[model samples]
Target: MAVQWHYPLMSNYPLESDTNNIAAYLYFFKVLHSRKEKVPDILDINDITTFTFFKSKSITHNHMSKWGLSDGMTAQLRENVPKYVQQINKS
Candidate 1:
């Protein structure tokens, strides 16, 4: 028998970047699924980094409006994370 566990942390603020937490969790799931192993009782995910929302003030209003109007930005991040993770694994 095989079991997969998912523990999602819900915070008011974004973790690192928008969709970053989801991307990271998916990455871990992918790794474990490939190995077909049960999730350990104790796992460390404390290394994840978080970025502050306040920094958004530095971004241009145009970009902010675009993100609000469409799913393009979100879709891009979701698509990029796996490729980025695979690239990291090669090194």
Candidate 2:
């Protein structure tokens, strides 16, 4: 017997405009879970609530470093997640 590992196929440019796709969405969740951070159940969350949650939860340099982000990229994400979440909701 052989065991097969199944994983979602992620896009080459995960943050591209095609993020409206389910695969991109799943990739987001996968990254979140990989962090092992405590996240609320966001399946039913509205944009406002999601924005509020992200606003309340700051992403530290340590967290970003753990995710292998460069200092500049970490800073970008720290500044962008909340703002980008709004744009994402609109799409």
Candidate 3:
């Protein structure tokens, strides 16, 4: 029989930017995989307090909307944007 362990990834402020957040997630995922550890598919940043630097959630939502980032887009960005940027940078 085989046992599997689960590890949760937490972030203070997710999607603060397109680049840094994705970079950090990629680095963390690489480190964990190299060590034969489990990495969660979803990043846990659902804490309302950590959602934004602003005091108001409404303000944060406004900013996110203006930037054209929905929750789905932000989640997908972490997985897809970094790789594209790396490829562009390498060329």
Candidate number achieving the greatest lDDT relative to the actual structure: 2
lDDT of 2 at 15: 39
Q: Which 10-residue window in model 2 sums to the lowest lDDT?
A: 38-47
Every candidate's lDDT:
0.35, 0.39, 0.38
For model 1, name the residue pairs that clash.
Answer: 16-50
Query: Which ranges in model 2 have alpha carbons more than 4 Å from their true place?
Result: 1-59
Name the runs in model 3 displaced over 4 angstroms: 1-68
- lDDT: the better of candidates 1 and 2: 2
Listed in order, each prediction's TM-score against the native is: 0.27, 0.34, 0.22
Least accurate 10 contiguous residues by lDDT in model 3:
46-55
- For candidate 1, report its TM-score: 0.27
Candidate 1: stretches off by over 4 Å: 1-69
Comparing 1 and 2 on TM-score, the stronger one:
2
Taking the tens digit of each residue's C-alpha lDDT, what string does model 2 give over 3-89? 121322222223344644333343444433433321222211212222232334554566646655556544543465655567678
The Cα RMSD of model 2 versus the native structure comes to 10.5
lDDT tens readout by residue for model 1, 6-65: 433322222333333443443433533322321221122322232222133454435433
How many steric overlaps are in each model, in order? Answer: 1, 0, 0
Residue-level lDDT of model 3, residues 1-91, one tens digit each, is 2212234343333433343343243443342242332222332333223212223435444454455445543444334545555654675
lDDT of 3 at 79: 45
